[model samples]
Target: MADNQFSLLSKRRFAPFFATQALGAFNDNVFRNALVILIAFGVAGLSSQQINTWSNVAAGLFILPFFLFSANAGQWAEKFEKSRSIRYIKLLEIAIMCAAAIGFYFKSLPVLVGVLFLMGTQSALFGPIKYSILPQQLKPEELVGGNGLVSGGTFLMILLGTLLGGALMAHPGLGTTWVSVAVLVIAVSGYLASRHIPLAPASNPDLKLNWNPFTETVRILGFLRGNRAVLNSVLGVSWFWFFGSMFLAQLPNYTREYLGGGAQVAPLVLALFSIGIGLGSMLCEKLSGRRVEIGLVPLGAIGLTVFGLDLYFARPEAATVTGLTAMEFLRAPGSLRIVADLLLIGLFGGFYIVPLLSLIQTRAPRDRLSRIIAANNILNAVFMVTAAVLALVLFAAGLTIPQVLLVTAILNALVATYIFSLVPEFLMRFISWLLVSALYRIRVQGTDRVPDEGPAVVVCNHVSYMDALIVMGCVKRPVRFVMYHRIFKIPVMSWIFRTARCIPIAPAKEDPELMERAFAEIEAALANGELIGLFPEGALTRDGEIAAFRSGIERIIAARPVPVVPMALRGMWESMWSRRGSGVGRMRLPRRFRARVELVADEPMSPSEVTAATLEARVRGLRGDAA
Candidate 1:
C-alpha cells in the first residue's frame, strides 16, 4: 500500500522511534561484546577458568534483571506516556554509559560488572515501552511492516556492534578509550533520537504500579490467560528465542569444534545469520500482503525444524585439515550446505517472530498491552534459561555439538506439533493458504468494502468447491463459513472445516433438523458480531455461470439484520474443483496451476436494501463477463 515496508523509514512518525531503538540495540551489544573481549583477552591476572566463570556470571547478571523487573516495567509503560518514559530511559542510559566509560578507563572489573547489570536493567525497562507504542502510533495495516523494520534494524545494529566492539577492544591502548567514547556517543545520540518520538498515550493510566516482582509476575501471567491465542503466540515466540539462543550461544564452540574455525569465523557465521533474518523479516510485509497473517507462523515453524535438522546433517565430515578460517570453510566441499542451513534457519525465525509480535500487540487487550508484552519478556527469559540448561544436559550426556543440534531440532518439531494441535486455527489457515496459493494467483478487489471489524454477512457467487478456502486466504480476518454439509465432510478438508467452526447446512427436504440448527448457529454467530460468510447461490456453478440467487439471503438478513456485503468470484469455474460439465459425470481434474482468479466485493448494502434479487444483480455486475 505504501510502496513497501522500507517506505516507512521516510515518514516522520516511525523514523525517530526506529533510530532510537536501533541505537539502543547497538549500544547494548557493543557494551556486551566489549565486556566479553575484556574477559577473554584484555583482562590480566585471571586464569582461563576464572575468565569463563566471570563470563558466565556477566551473562547471568544481564538476564537476571529481565526476570526481576519485567513485570514492574510493564506496569510503568502502561501507567505513563510511552515517549516520555522512553526519553527518561534514554537519559538513564546516558548516565549508565558515563559509569561504563569510567569503568572502562580505569580497567576495573567490578565497576564494569556493576555497569553491565545496570545496562540490563535499562533494557528490561525499555522492552515493554517499545512494542506497546507501535499499536498506538501506527495503523493496524502498518503494524507488520513497522515490526519488520524494527526487527531488521535491531538485528543489523547488533551485528554491527558485535563486529565493532570486538575490533575496537583488540586494539592496544586506544581500545578502551575508543570503546568508552563510542558507547557514550551512541548513548547521547539515542537520547537525542528519543526526543523526536511522538507521544503515545498510556494504555492503562489507572493501573496501579505493583512493586513486588514475584507476585506481579504471577498476576500478569494470569492476566495473559484471558486470551489463549495471545498466550500461545507469546509462548511460540519464546520458543523461537530458546531455539535461537541455542544456536547463538553454542556458535563459537560449534565453529571451533565442528567446523575447525577460529574466533573470526563465528562472527562471520553470525553475520550471515543476521542478514538472513533481516531479509526474511522485510519480506513478511510482502508475503502477508501487509496484514498480520498468523498462517506464516506455522510455515516458519516448519522451516525452523526442517532447516535445523538439515544443519545437523550438513556438518561436513571432519576434514583432516585444521585452522580452517571462515573463507576457507566456505571454499570447502559441503560447507555451503551448513551456511545455507543457518541462513534459512534465521530466515524462518524472522517469519515466525514478526507475525507473532504483531499478534501480541493486536490481539492482547489494548488496556493491558504493555503488561502482556512484559509477561512475554519474562517467559522469553525463562525459555532461554531452559535452553541453556537443556544444552548443558545434552553435553553431559556425551552428545556432540551436531548431535545437540539434532536433538533441539527434533524437540522443536514435537513442541511445534503440540502447539499447533492446541490451536488449529493457525494450521487451518496455513492449509487454506497453501491450497489457494498452490492452485491459483488470487487478485482481490474492493476488500475494504468489508468491515474491518463487527458482524457482517458476505454473500458470494460460489463457482467451485474451493471457494471458501480461497476466500479464507484472501480475507485478512477469519470468517466462519456457512457451507454445504456434504462439502464440509470432504475427506482431508473436513478437519480444517471443523477447526474453523464452519456451519454446514442441508436442504430442508433432505435434513430439516440440520438446516434448522445451521440457521440457529449462523444467527448466534451474527449476534456475537462475528463475520459469517455464505453463498447465496447455495451451490457451486454447474456450467461456469452464476445460478439464480436463492431466498435464503433474504431470510438471513431478515433474522439478523446486519449489513450484507455482496461479492463475486470470477475465473474459478475452470479451476480444478469446479463442475464444468452438464452433470457430475463429467467432473475433471485441475485444468490449470497458478491460474488468475479475482474476488470482487461491492459496497455493503444496508439490511433493508439487501433483497435477494438486488444482491444477485450487484454480484453479477461485479463479475462482468469474467465467468
Candidate 2:
C-alpha cells in the first residue's frame, strides 16, 4: 500500500477515474456558466424579466433531477457494473452536450434550459457510482487519502469550469460557439477517459430494480435510519452543502456591495475560498495520519463558525468605494482580513467534510451503499433549496447580506453542536486527537497488521498514563482499552476514558468483583467482533523498563480463543505523563514539548500461541532499543 495518497494518482486504478470526473465537472460548469452569462447579457435577446426568470429556471432545472431521479439512479448504480455505468452516463453527457450545441447555435433559451435538465440527470446518475466505487478499488488505509484527492479535485475543477465558462461567453462574437465546442469535446474526452477505468463489479447484482422514485426515495431513506451514526454522518454531509450553498449564493453580492469590488473581485473571492477547500482537503491525510479521522470534523466545524463570524466583523459595513478590481480590493483597508476569513472558512470546510464521506463509505452496508449515497444526494438538494429560500426570506425581512452571513454562521454552530451531540464519537475522537497531536510527534508502523474487521486482542507495553490516548489516536479503528481503574478516574482523563468506552479494570487483589466484571465485558466485546486493547503489564512502568506480563491476558484468550496482536510504545518514558522519576517532581512541566514517539504493531498470534511470556517477548522485541 502506498504511504502517501498522492501516490495513488500515478496508479491506473485512480488516475483514469480522476481525469474522467474532473473533466465532467469542468464541462458541467462550462455549460452552466455560459448559459447564465448568455441570458444575463441579453445574448438570447429576451426581456429583462424573462432573463431573470430563465436564470432562476436554469438553476432549478439542474437541481431538480437530483430530487426526481436520484432514487432510480441509485438502483441502477447498484444493479450494474460501476465502470460500465460510468461509460453510459458519460455517453448521456455527450448526447446532452450535442443538444446544448444546437441550443447555443440558435440561441434558444428554452432548449438550452432543457439540455441543462438532461445534464443534471446525467450527474444524478453518476453521483452514487462516483463514491460507492472507491472502497471497492482502494485499500482501507487509502480511503481517506483517496477521498481527499477526489474532494479537492472536484472543487478545483468547479473553479476552473466556472472561470472558463464565463470567459468563453464573454467573447465578442463566437463566445457561444466556443462554449458549445468546449462542452462537446470535454464530454467526449470524459467518455474516453471512462473507458480506462477498471471494471468495478455490481455491488448488488441481483437487486430488484425500483422504478418508483417516490416510494424508493422513502424506502432508501429508511436505510439511513438503520444506523444512527451513518444517518447523522449523512446529515452532516448535507448540512455542509447547505452551509456551502448559503455562502456561495451570497458571495457575489457580498464581494460587490460590501468589499467594494467590480466583476473581477467575485471570482477572486471564489478562488480564495476554493483554494482553501482544496488545500484543506489535501491536508486531511497528513493531519489524520491517513485514517478516516472524524476528529477533524469537529475541528472543521469550529473553524467554519469562527471564521464565518469573523467575516462579518472584518467588514461589517459596505465598502466606502465601488468598482475596484481584484488587486485594488486586496489593497483596500480591512480587505485582507475579509479575504483571510473567506479563505479559512473554505479551508475549515474542507477539514469538516472529507472524513464524513469516508465514514459513510466504510460504515454503510456495502450492497446498499449506492442507495445511501443517493439518499444523501436527495437530502443535499433539499438543503440547498432550503438555503436559497432562507436567504430570500432573510432578504425580504431586510437583513443585509453581512447579517445573513452572520446568522448562517451562528446557525452553523447550533447545527454542528446538535449533530455532534447526537454522535458523541465525533467529539470524543476529536478530543483524543487534539490532546495526542498536541503533545507528541508520533510515527506509526505495522498498523496494517491489525485486522480491518474482526475480533482480536491487542497487548501493548504500558509506558505512560497517556498510552491509551496515543494508541487510540494511531489505530484506524476504535479500541476499548482495558485501563487501570485509577487512571480511568484521573480528573480530565476520566471523562475521555468513559466517553471512549474504555473498560476500567481493578487488580484482582483490590477489587475482585470489578476485575471479574471487566473480564466478562472484554469477553463480550470480543464476541461482538470488537477489538480489545490490553496493557498486559497492568501498570505504567516505574523505571522505564518492561514489566512482567499479567496472567489476565492468558485467561481472557483461553476463554475466547481469538487472535492476539502484540504492540509496543517507544520513547514515552521521558514524557510528562509517565512514571519515570522517583518522586512527585515527575508530575511537573516536561523538559520538552511535542516529544517524538512511536507505536509499532506485530502480526497477530493464534490464541494457542499467545501465552503471557510469549506475547511479552514479542512486544518487547517490537519496542527494541527505542525505549
Local accuracy by lDDT, each model: 0.88, 0.90
lDDT of 2 by residue, 1-627 (tens): 697999999988998998899899989999998988888883645788988799899999999999999999899989999999999999999999999999999999899999999989989999999999999989877888999999999998999999999998888999989998999999999999999999999999999997899999999999999888789989999999999999998998888889989989988998999999998998999998777889999999999999999998898888888999988988888888988998899999999999999999987888999999999999999999999999999999999999999999999999999998888889988988888888888888887688767899888999887899888877776789999998999997888888888999998789999999999999999999889999998888888899999899989998898888899998988875777665667465454468899898999998889899998899989999887
Worst 10 contiguous positions by lDDT, candidate 1: 581-590
In angstroms, the error of model 2 at 303 is 0.9
> What clash pairs does model 2 have?
none
lDDT of 2: 0.90
Q: Compute the lDDT of residue 480 as modeled in candidate 2.
A: 93
Tell me, by TM-score, which candidate is best: 2
What is candidate 2's CA lDDT for residue 611? 90
